[model samples]
Target: MGRQRPPRLPPRKMTGSLPTVILAGCGYGAIDALRALKGQARVIAINPYPYIVNSGMSTRLLSGRFSLDLVRIPLLEHIHTNGAEYVQGRVTQIQPEVQTLTVQTELGRRRLAYDYLLVNVGRELRTIAGIHHAFTIRPAEQLLAAQTWIRDCWRRAAQGDPTPGLLTFVVAGGGCTGTELMGELYDLCQEMSATTGIPLTQARWVLINRNRYLATGIAVEKEGQNNRFSRCIETGIRRLGVEIWAECQVKAFGPEQVWLEDGRELLAQTRLWAGGLQVPQWLSECGLPVGPEGSLIVDECLRVKGSERILAMGDCADFAWGSQTRRLPKIGVYAVRQGPIAAQNLLRLIRGQPLIPYRPQATAFVCVTVGNRIAVAKKGWFIWRGYWATVLKNLFDWLYMRNLKPVRWREFFY
Candidate 1:
């Protein structure tokens, strides 16, 4: 025998021969990986939930048609809350050699040991020059709160004393999140007027896209992209009464407003910064090797460099797919995919077998809800436009959530 390989370790409980597995982050990445682990190892999770709002969907949630809760997967509903141990804390530091993490929780500072460690902690973004800030929705409750504000704004506009900025809801990114958000709110504006009796003129869903054209990535056909951009215009970007500004970068921020690259300035009391996302600072702080974008550079096995005991996935990880270099686009699909891989690799480690590498998909699709019961579906060489696309998109969102971490755990067990 090759020096007698160690036996596959069993999952450690409070007291056991197996070591603990400390998984940070409760996002789709963290929670997904943990759920796939089954009984391979002990697990612990940390996240500041019932807090943070991404605001991408905030405006839509605020409008009261959909609840913010629709966006988040509660950790307790999936993780440690059932039987595993969970610390309502954030991991401030990770030491690989000793395999321990330093965390600050409601109780206080504590160091916990682990046999295997995972860093799924998602990234953070700042708005309004990093002062007086709001966050993306971390829990479902945040959506309900957003609903209240939308109602209040409706009240002001309905009373004929509409605040100058009350009519404006500026979303600043062009990513799928921002794209869907702006488009959703635009639809809500139409619904609010028709249903709540509030005039469509009272609510504005302004999308500030830095790209010269919206859907920059999905615009596969150079002419088709231009045609789609034209369609957005003809599709009532202006006729729907929502303001659309492209290639407008933020020059400066003010307490109550944002100055744009264009000479013409926009002043809105409600400023939402959806201007894309930078990777988290903590990955660098934890002393792991990071790529240019602040994401962790992982080997083919999804293992962080210079450490065999640690792994990364989702938004924080950069893996080589096939081409020059790529991270898995930091989407729900990739995170969900990484979950099973991470779990399998953990088992391989426990069994002293070859670790399996994660493979990327051949293509992906984006389903965006456009106003008037219409949606736009963009995939490689394919575009499904109209109400049917919106219906498909809504159905997809429902089914995806339903199967992955569905409302009922019994389904998973069975």
Candidate 2:
């Protein structure tokens, strides 16, 4: 099938007297907020792309199991159908003092005024030296290119082109994204080996992590002690014939080498980096109260610190979990939970009603896909893995995208 194109939205005539709620970025939280604000306020969503890519299924897209069309939700059609305006542009500047935004669009720069603003720009992939030569798992579009590159490598290897590192794939991190990617890459290589009649032993797969264990930052506790989720993940990936290099850091990437911080190098033609993530630098310079990692500090009501008319969530906002001042993890589950609350609070703020404080769930479900029809899931201290876990992950993804559809279709399908 051909790649899907986002529909071009015509210039909307601003005729409504309703208060305008501008969503800085149409991420998971912002999209949910947009749905709640429908018909209540004039909503304008500003995003660089006319569609939102679901990052949860991104590895599947890279493995060629999911297509671009399946992972991307076209924003123009849904926003317009829900009584909102969509602006395809990058937010250049935020003049909070004047309650306005300067967006750089295809035509030119445009100044947009709003009564309330919701910032959910999200985070970008962290980069290292010579990162331009390696594939970073972000922008969602880049995964398509990586997929094409893998196919080309397979073709060359099948024809006995004798290219160095032709079947070697190196993943430069053992975080969730990196782990999933390594598993999928291994699966792809094995499939290719079977199809091209090449020996599977000829291919090499490596995962490099700076931490002592895989998924170091993830919270997996059981009875006041850490659980075995990380250990399980490490064992699972290793069983797939992947070399795990713990406590290792990548210094840079050369033409066909992954340079290590310890002065060692690994030769691999295809390199994938999933080191870390960081908020946009522009966010810190926007004069907003920012916390760690330059994420905007948000209060209990999901409002930006000291700003009544501005709210932030998702990876772009540093939201405290409780009185202890621990920030919530930058994940889709938190954003999904915060979306409706943020929208409701925005409406209450406008109506002079008592706003509700957002209290995060005590324990959230976390799941990571390792390979085709294989996954690991955790909730509190309980852990599950294998095909059943993968099923649960797919169900979650399906429900998220299904809810993004118009109400009419949702009701009909139900």
Candidate 3:
């Protein structure tokens, strides 16, 4: 993909000036919106973190293949270069009726008023009892912590005291996160075994899924197409000596074992969760039109159903589209695409022009890396796996970051 500058956005030239367009969340979607409407509107971005973690490359972070500083870029620099203000605060409450936001900052709580609002705060992890006992990849910090723990485990195994479960790395979830995690773990363990002389048998890699196969609910077609993709991933993982436990539900977590719903216990100390994502609890409490997952309900134009001035995007939004009003999936790919669309629609409304409806592509592309320079990608009926797939994944990751990089960073790279 070639580098193309975003359309320059100068403030709308109307009879009177408008209030600032406040975008909450500094994820891919929010940043894209900020890029499009940077100079066009008085834009302010509110996010708890100071950096935007490139989750596309986060899987490599697990295996110590990539560093955090490389994947996570400072949002302040990006916002400043794009001619926008970055608010280092978390939005505690949103009052759409008064168009005021209660933000929690270092100087205590402050109320911010905005003419238009964009909610892309995204989802929170669906936690369970003893979830703290497991490692998660949502926050970039968690990945750093996991890296330390994994290295320590490898060292311990080298000393002949490969603690139970510590060597048996278990990833719970069959989705993209789980699949990528398994691949990275496979390579990590294999490299550690070869370097430290730890037997591969001593180090266990397991993937537990409630469903019978992996990538269960993606754009996979029926008539065993899902199984075909599942088999492809299964082959890739198993070839790397990974164990797959299907149709099994994790009941609870323990320090040294994972209890199963079927009265079975898996001996493993390390558990990585990549399943069950839910929107923030505050979204539903704020009296907005939220869906079952606590995501704000948005119309085809990506506008919040009840309030025209307020819009929602990314994983934080439950969008209804087309005649059937089908709900879209919560994927980073969609979030990146929706950013400019939402920005355009907002600009159209500001200019008194008709808002265009967002129509998602019928087939969503998805890929999972399978250790040792291999990956599996699915686009409609076509499925590719091997070295070429891995090359595609790397190119895609570079393009994703390249498109979202700040002006200064883009200058340094390009």
The residue-level lDDT of candidate 1 at 363 comes to: 57
Task: Give lDDT tens digits, candidate 1, residues 1-414.
Answer: 022323334433445545567777665555555666657666776676633233323434634545555544556766654345678888777877678888888889889888787777767653445334332332345435545555566667777864577767776666556665566566655655665687676566677778766655432234665456435633544455666777777665565566777755676655555566667666787778988778888777777877777888877887655544444566556666777787777667655676777775655656655556566776655666777766666565566556544443222110
103-189 in candidate 2: lDDT tens per residue? 999999999999889998888888899999898898777777887788788889999888889899999998888888887787777
Clashes of 1: 9
Off-target runs (Cα >4 Å) in candidate 2 are: 1-16, 220-227, 406-414
lDDT of 2: 0.80
CA shift at 14, candidate 2, in angstroms?
15
Decreasing lDDT order of the candidates: 2, 3, 1
TM-score of every candidate: 0.81, 0.90, 0.89
What candidate 1 gets wrong by more than 4 Å, as runs, is: 1-16, 50-60, 80-82, 130-143, 195-198, 201-205, 215-239, 251-256, 261-264, 404-414
Q: lDDT, candidate 3, residue 124?
A: 72
lDDT of all predictions? 0.61, 0.80, 0.77
Q: Point out the higher-scoring one by lDDT: 1 or 2.
A: 2
In terms of TM-score, the best-performing candidate is 2
| Cα shift from native, residue 28, model 2 (Å) | 0.4
Model 3 poorest 10 in a row by lDDT: 1-10
